[model samples]
Target chain A: MTIDDGPASDRVRLRRGANNGVYERQAVLDVLDAGLIAHVGVATDDGPIVIPMAYGRSDDSLYLHGSVANAALRAADGTDVCVTVTVIDGLIIGRSPFHNSMQYRSVVVRGRARRLQDDAERVDALRRVSNHVVATWDQARPPTADELRRTMVIAVPLLEMSAKVRTGGPVDEPEDLDGRHWGGSVPITSTFGDAVPSPDLRPGVGVPSSVAALDGTAVHGLTTRP
Target chain B: MTIDDGPASDRVRLRRGANNGVYERQAVLDVLDAGLIAHVGVATDDGPIVIPMAYGRSDDSLYLHGSVANAALRAADGTDVCVTVTVIDGLIIGRSPFHNSMQYRSVVVRGRARRLQDDAERVDALRRVSNHVVATWDQARPPTADELRRTMVIAVPLLEMSAKVRTGGPVDEPEDLDGRHWGGSVPITSTFGDAVPSPDLRPGVGVPSSVAALDGTAVHGLTTRP
Candidate 1:
């Protein structure tokens, strides 16, 4: 297995397939763009806690939001945190039990997450995070002073980020060739469905083109290409 | 918010979103079935390690396998472990930053994992794990004694488990509704594509009907109508 060296800004040198794995930069960004919820792993005084939070990416910086009083945000500030975003493509069914694996794209970012203090920077971070989920959403409505005051946002510079990917058929051992097991691969795909208008919406509210255009296409345009 | 008075097994509780969550048994099982890889969270002497592992479920028991020499397997045995499986459904776009949330289906299982000792039981557990990705695989081939010896499988009884799910549009605070922000939901759905035969397969190898029949359906049939 070939291991690619990480960028200079990387702090925690990923061990490639060992401790830290980064197959390619584009693959990692693709998985990050396609995902909305990230499992933020933070080491606390008690133990490690994996908290699911909404995150947004701007180039290499990843921003996350939580309650102002949340324990995860406090523990993660100025400390090395592991933020993982995984997108499962399919299931690999090998002829033998030992050969089965999952086709997935995952990005592991290890860095010190600093709490955003400046009002303007915090607002910009919130907008970036919002736009990640739905483009042009930040311009739709900006946060009020009070709303921003109640929310806490943290920024983790993707310095030592690495993306690891596994695709294609199961790599079964040669000794198991004649086992006659029904082994193969199952390709998983995710897409967006027709937009369901909210029940409380006023009658005759037309769906926005951005939301309507998602039908029949991958939600985030993130999938393994042949 | 109504705290579900249902039995402990039926109550779906999440510390994050206590309100607007479902605890139905079928719903929980569907989420578990649809997932391919599960992040096994185990508390080790050093700290907490979340390892990705392939899993098989039989009735109320979830099975996990690892190398016999792996420290994860050793720490998981005879200890309380938390196994979390989360499937992202969509991105909720709220008018304000505080209201943003991800539509997801996640199950948090807390219980003790016991190592499988009996050869017969171990063989059966391996078979179930195999059939998890590919149905009808258990009867296709039997594992050799040596193969079973190299693998260590642990079964975690789902005695204390809970499933948390979030769907639909963003729950914006009343004041932010008319705040000029475009608020809606970006729905996500996962489907299985047509099966692709392995490149190394022998010529004229017919595609199994079980694999071929999964087109356009959720891989594990995890969708349930409530």
Candidate 2:
């Protein structure tokens, strides 16, 4: 998890909190696994566009999908894309206002994302992304051939990815040591509430065991649950 | 709040949920107020770069600040920037995985952001931004002249902005009705928790009432709180 062992390129370097940062393969995978949506940044002809897209991780590869006609997805194919997933744990309110920061675990992956041309590979990627949001989604109902044809999936190998993280309290300047401002942290925790059945649900269809079994936290949080 | 009443540009038009979507002045303001970060999309020599930055709203304008020497600030001055703020409220899980979508509220403002040349305006914008994050922050410690000199603030009038929102349950296709699959939603709510006191707080200095009384939730939900 040391900074020295992070991505070799300068772009993925950790500028802040170098001491407490984690850039190891396992650490980056953990952060990605915990996140559901990824803020995807793509360089477009007009400018850089950041779109919130659902993503999935399989081994060391990251998969993303959008409509087949989506320009961002088309442009991202065979090009370098900066995919960032940020989980804000809390607001680190320091003694001094200047020291205030966010306690977040973020992974910035910079790599060339190529379109998945193989049908089997694309279907597998789509299934992985579907299960990323819901564990039982893959087994629920498979997408028809027409549906698969209309969807575009891209894969980015995580060879050059890096995870930069910051935790703990604010590091205020020496002069602000005795400041009277009340500051510490406002912790943030993301959880899933009980599934609310659709109002138009069909009769006699009981809730799936997978959906009913879900607790009030993220699906990935199940492993961490006591 | 109809699409016709919004910006004349085709890109700002609502393609989905046109009937239920909102584009009114207050709706746009509400979306801005509910968010703390904005993705500033700027054009670079190579391609477009989108960076996440803290933002503040005042009247009909949005303000963003950065170091004077930062390339983003320099490139953004007097240039058309696409400032977007999005908050995902929930995961709209549907019976068919293809219908799974995110319940989100997002506002996009497209205009040329002008740098504040006047010192007074810069200071005022800074105050507005600081107050947006923490209501009592501006009055707590006014920026010194040196601090002001080191920072650059840009203001973009919210004139040609559009608010796009998607709420309620999933809009599943009718054909998937009888499919024996679970369908519902995973709700998400963000809130401020009990403030923790700084470890180095001076004895006898209590938390200010302004900070203590703060209930950091979507302003629209203020009256809807349980």
Candidate 3:
């Protein structure tokens, strides 16, 4: 498939299924912001490593949060890294097994991740990360000074990024559509169950609004509200 | 954080959050089977790239399937690669944002992927992959010979692997527990939605038992049954 449109970077080019590739910056950012987890790829002496880590997006960069001692976090420093976030929407069951596929939206960002050395920047990054997971950042207790010192936050600029999405029902060949086989799509959604309050919570402290608002909401498509 | 009993390979060691790392083989396999998609890491000349791909597991290896033109599949051949599968179970909302975390089970496998050159092996791999996606592969139309030829399958052995998991309520400091903030865990579950029948399906062809069985089932936890 031809390079329809997107960042003209070699690293972000889609070599296969070009029709599903999305090059728009806003689209890529939307996928990044919607996802709370990213699998970060870092090259190491042993080989390449992919680790699942919590992340947040701000402006043109993605912030990855972890402990300073995390292997993947340490390996990503000064080296080119890939951060990929995927949200599976459904399973497309076609008439034939060959045509069966998944409905998903995935974003891949490649850049050098620089460690946030400034404590203020690092704390801000952590807040972003927290907000991404739970929309109630201000209501939740902020990290203490010592806690900020212990966490490692890496900022990867969204210089080269792409979003690939697959949706709708299975695309079966005309001949197979007439065959005696059923085909369809099963939607898969991420939902939150009942909130189990902490056993040691004080008697008067009730479930905060920020935490209660998460019920029945989509995990990735959390509302961007106050 | 001690290196609790697990494969002691240097590549599989947990460098951080040692308390959350699990070293058992069965535990790792459970997480692998419970995940429909994996973020695969491959080293390239430009840097490291991670891409989301569909995968199936056999006795001792993981099979990755994609079109022949997929770049990440081509790059993983004969090179060390990392495949990570993660299932988010819940959100650990701590009293402090710093302590907030996700309850997830993740498996990381590091090994060199070998391209399946043998047609028999390739077809078997494809069958396994299909079955992994839909348990009723026997009822669905099998892949034609040409279709089989156009697909690429890579086999990465389960050599150096580790599973990291976080479970239960948030662990807040004693002082924070008394603070006027609610803290707990919001369970996250991946559930399947209704199956929308294909518009072009023949009038006589109704939803098959295989397709109807998918309702209410977890996407990754589908039983390996007919």
Candidate 4:
């Protein structure tokens, strides 16, 4: 299949809790955009292993960079992979510990992840990933030819994916709701603190606009839930 | 293996970047204790998949609670599993886009995960899982007998595990250091927002002490780096 048009279409059907499945592609895209990392899974001879990696999403493709967990992508090497991103919305305290739950928005994308070989494609994918995290790829110094050649990036078609969300508050049994147990939700928030300048930064290099925009604002999906 | 001692001693060998491996058991334990969730990987008939799970660690075993992603644990019944947790500490802006990296600590625990059958073990494991997220299990209403019976829980021995850490700042090319590129790290933080009471909560119910501890202090590994 061509890189632009993948064979992925409707491969994800939740084994259970079917009602929580989100069919809208936009919902999947929203979670992908808000997440900082993707938990990448690949089958190996030994067993299935999951590793966290920084990733960026194109229209219908996910570009996974060869970063800290570079070994995970290199090992996948054009094999079936599942890329999942989870943004926890809040904690639901229920009348019973058994009813305690987390309000979260999660997406699972299943497809064969092919390592991009073309330098041009690799550069584009790398830029997407870099920009997705902090949105300064345009202003930052671009990757050199040698760097591009050395980087190992992979692309996963986003066509076969579904999102599962647990929103609102705890679902407690009627008898326990008004009892002694506290029944409510505690919200969780992730935010970028004030950008700290590098000790060795040039005398007058100001913080880039993209980094400047991260002044205690909320990270989507991970922050502020109703 | 007994519940107290897992067969996991050393199953993790970094496929690459061996220097970053932290072999200390305490290092692995510290990362696990500080983290809020585990990205669990399991092989399915279709392919390998990774799922985000809320997990807890006793002295040697990890207790995984069946929450939103219960399907994954059920599929992994009595199978080898890889549970990984990554806590991002900071974003490193480098002299070149290629050098951009994240400062973080992560642990990968691999073992045969078995679903717990004993009621006593299940109760203990579930309590550990609850307390790990927000240490209020003692105060929260305990699970009912039926709740215990219906809950699906799995235990992964922390015997075979390793911790990979990347701390400190960006490591730019020697020549690129003095160039125009900004080289520093933007620290990322995760904290519990104010406890938001559920709409129908009784007016006399005040925030619990365990949750009150969440007033803006840093989450261990996800916040602040030197």
**Which candidate number maximizes TM-score?**
3
Q: For model 4, how does the per-residue alpha-carbon lDDT over A1-226 read when each residue is reduced to its tens digit?
A: 0122222354576655566677577766777887878899988776888888888878879988775346667778778999999887677777678878787878889888898878788888898888777777877787877777678889999888877788777778888756777877777777777778777677888788777877787766332111
The superposed Cα distance between candidate 3 and the true structure at residue A109, in angstroms, equals: 0.4
- Encode model 2's per-residue lDDT on A133-173: one tens digit a residue: 56656546667788788899999888776775776667665
What are the DockQ scores of the candidates, in order? 0.36, 0.46, 0.79, 0.57
Ranking by TM-score: 3, 4, 2, 1
DockQ-wise, the better of 1 and 2 is 2
lDDT of 2 at A199: 79
B-chain TM-scores per prediction: 0.86, 0.88, 0.92, 0.90
TM-score to true structure, per model: 0.83, 0.87, 0.95, 0.90
TM-score (C-alpha) between model 3 and the true structure: 0.95
lDDT: worst 10-residue window of model 1 chain B: B4-13
Candidate 3 residue lDDT tens string, B69-178: 78888988999999999988888888888788888888899998999999999888877777775675777877788888888999999878998888888889889988
**Model 3: how far residue A131 lies from native, Å:** 0.1
List, residue by residue over A110-211, the lDDT tens digit for candidate 1.
677899999988888887777675554534456678788878889988666666667788766675555444556777887777766555444555566666
- As for candidate 4, its clashing pairs are B8-B159, B8-B160, B9-B159
Pairwise lDDT winner, candidates 1 and 3: 3
**Candidate 1 chain A weakest ten by summed lDDT:** A11-20
Q: What fraction of the true interface does each of the listed models get right, in terms of native contacts kept?
A: 0.33, 0.45, 0.91, 0.70
lDDT of model 3 at position B72? 84
Error of 4 at B140 (Å): 2.1
Winning candidate number (DockQ): 3
lDDT of 2 by residue, B4-102 (tens): 355546544444445645667777778888765677776655344455566887787899987787676688887777787777777777787777777
